[model samples]
Target: MKKIVFLFAFGLAALFAQAQSPAKIGFADVEYIFSQMPEAKQIETELQTLQTQLKKQYDGKVAEFQKKLQEYQAYGNTVPDAVRQNTERELQQLQQNIQKLEQDSQENLQRKQVQLMEPVYTKVGKAIEEVAKANAFTMILTNQVSGLDVVLYADDQSDISDLVLKKMGITPQAATTNPPKK
Candidate 1:
């Protein structure tokens, strides 16, 4: 019984030792990858076009609102009490409508961006996965410069941004800059 218990403990230790492979960490800057992707440029152009259209509509509404406000200011005293109140209500409604439209435009732009970016995000994500697996990276971290940077002190040698871009068939520029470790 004692011999069997010892053997069982030894087998568990061996299994644990086999499971404890060293973690090979790698980081990729996805934003850099997106900047190198042509799809991202097209998406930006589409978003800008949508924004211009929304801006035109918004400007038209503002012009209409301003004309109404000016007319109210010019003729308000001469107008009858009921007429004045009605004009005031119309002006208030126009202001509210303008605010609502502005909010809606912002939301529409955000939605469009997400809609356009979803596929690109997926494509880049898959490429990252492939690169990580092919290179035997146990973990991959996002090295976003603008947002929450998860990596604090990664050596540029460990950067997989160029690898990811290459995996996606994008030849990385010779001048791609990787920030030095902090």
Candidate 2:
């Protein structure tokens, strides 16, 4: 009958649709993985040392500038016009040097951080890829809790962060309870 045929067709369509749906989606927190890495602590220590050294140098420059500024303020009015103008030029140059040094230090710190973290990031990325391929994950989303939320909602079972860590030969901590489901 026409009704039977139509019902059969509809059932076949539904089954096909279900077959075509994505198999799995996973979430990972790369920052969390980095926090667990031993090398990360070492990198932090190195960066801190560099920062401290830079700060000391910066402080010395600042002290020098302050000393010069004080001298100018105290003796500026008593000095000859040409001497005052030359001191002003020197002060301006010192200020410019201080600003340049601060900028360079910041840039150097950033560069060093990237250089140190690059290998760790690559290792984590490869582990994530391996886990995704082995588990047949259709997509693996980063779940970093920066200012913006990367993932709105994911089932606890769909988190692949532990698996990636395990792939990297790191034992994961006990799983935490999932957030309340909506």
Best by TM-score: 1
Q: Provide C-alpha RMSD values for all models, in order.
A: 2.8, 5.3
For residues 1-182, could you state the per-residue lDDT of candidate 2 as single tens digits?
99999999999999999899977888887777777677878999999999999999899999999999999999957999999899889989999999999999999999999999999999999999999999989889886556356777878788788888889888877544333233
After superposing candidate 2 on the true structure, give the runs of residues whose Cα lies further than 4 Å from its correct spot.
1-21, 174-182
Listed per model in order, the count of residue pairs whose N, CA or C atoms clash below 3 Å is 0, 0
lDDT of each: 0.90, 0.85
Query: Can you give the lDDT of residue 154 in candidate 2?
Result: 79
Error of model 1, residue 107, in angstroms: 0.5
State the TM-score for model 1: 0.88
Model 1 root-mean-square deviation: 2.8
All candidates: TM-score: 0.88, 0.82
